[model samples]
Target chain A: DAGITQSPRHKVTETGTPVTLRCHQTENHRYMYWYRQDPGHGLRLIHYSYGVKDTDKGEVSDGYSVSRSKTEDFLLTLESATSSQTSVYFCAIRPQVYSGNTIYFGEGSWLTVV
Target chain B: DQQVKQNSPSLSVQEGRISILNCDYTNSMFDYFLWYKKYPAEGPTFLISISSIKDKNEDGRFTVFLNKSAKHLSLHIVPSQPGDSAVYFCAASSPGAGSYQLTFGKGTKLSVIP
Candidate 1:
């Protein structure tokens, strides 16, 4: 409903393979973030971008990487995916800057590594 | 250490009753708190939020109460319906750090029985 879309909504990949997930938004929001959800972990941030080409690592950025080339597109890359990395990934955007606006999340992408 | 925590893993409430969910935070810097609801196969949606300056904020049947002294927050849903059953997550952010730095709790599943 927020005009956010995540590609490859469901995918099963083998271990040691490379995978990338794309997030596209039509709202033109400046801040975009990638988060992973696990059973015991609510949501852990992997990476975030404040503006095009500006990215920062989050608390759980060990094996993941992200890139933002345009205002509407943010990409997350998992190089040599591991079984431990299997989880549901979500992309979110903050509606405004310097305000207490709520962040909207896109339908999650489920990834499985075997 | 986990900054945000939701002690209860699940809660059950009868229809038309009240459902209360609790969250706690360890960081004193957190000034903004948010509650999100997630149904199966979809992303978590923003439900309500409150700032540290206020003790309570209400929106329709949903109310969020903040106890700054105790570093705790709770969400109440009156006249709970079956549609209200879902996983609820509590998130906290420091206003100074902005919204992208939100820390989320593990979440509590709510079941509204008819």
Candidate 2:
């Protein structure tokens, strides 16, 4: 898993609730990303951080916000969870070296919203 | 509007036969491409990668071929094994985009029958 951990590996929540998923890495890599995987959608980047406190929106960034207050942690928060947001979330880290820009992925956090 | 696309939803191949997965992209600036394999309940894992500057990259039984002019790429696994059955995703990234964030396809599920 490339020394990456995603907290709350499985969670069931209600619609209109708030949820936050945490990603921690021991690699101390400068780049970290949050992605969601759903049927028919392999993986869509929700947000990414290039450095501490530097985050940017991705293709499916709507309703999702991310924060990186420290070098080892990147957090993704769903301000208001929706039924459509129920999916498997993955955290990834990229090594500084450009070994074909390879990125490593965590196990994944499955969230179900009712 | 997906920048990357994997047309096949699923593929079935005989054990010890050849397996080929295809992907296409619409972005002209994409300079890097990669293939990832995912099993049930696990995040996608990096399998192989290729740069736009090169046409082919080989690693063990996996070979990735890139055609920059057609904006397409494929992964060929010769003598495929049943253990290779999984969902395969094709991802792309542009170096000039400043961030190494990747765009991924819908993925193709591969089933290797014994």
In candidate 2, the residue pairs with backbone N, CA or C atoms under 3 Å apart (3 or more residues apart, or in different chains) clash, namely: none
Alpha carbon lDDT at B15, candidate 2: 95
Best by DockQ: 2
- Individual DockQ of the candidates? 0.73, 0.85
> Can you write out model 2's per-residue Cα lDDT over A1-57, one digit (the tens) per residue?
588999999999999999999999987899999999999888998999999999999
lDDT against the true structure, each candidate: 0.93, 0.94
TM-score of 2: 0.97
Per-candidate clash tally:
0, 0
Q: In angstroms, give how far residue B32 of model 2 lies from its true place.
A: 0.7
The superposed Cα distance between candidate 2 and the true structure at residue A20, in angstroms, equals 0.8
Top lDDT hit:
2
lDDT tens digits by residue: candidate 2, B1-114: 889999999999999999999999999999999999999999889999999999999999999999999999999999999999999999999977646888999999999999
Worst 10 residues of 1 chain B by lDDT: B93-102
Q: For model 1, what is the error of residue B39's alpha carbon versus the real structure, in angstroms, after optimal superposition?
A: 0.3
lDDT of 2 at A79: 99
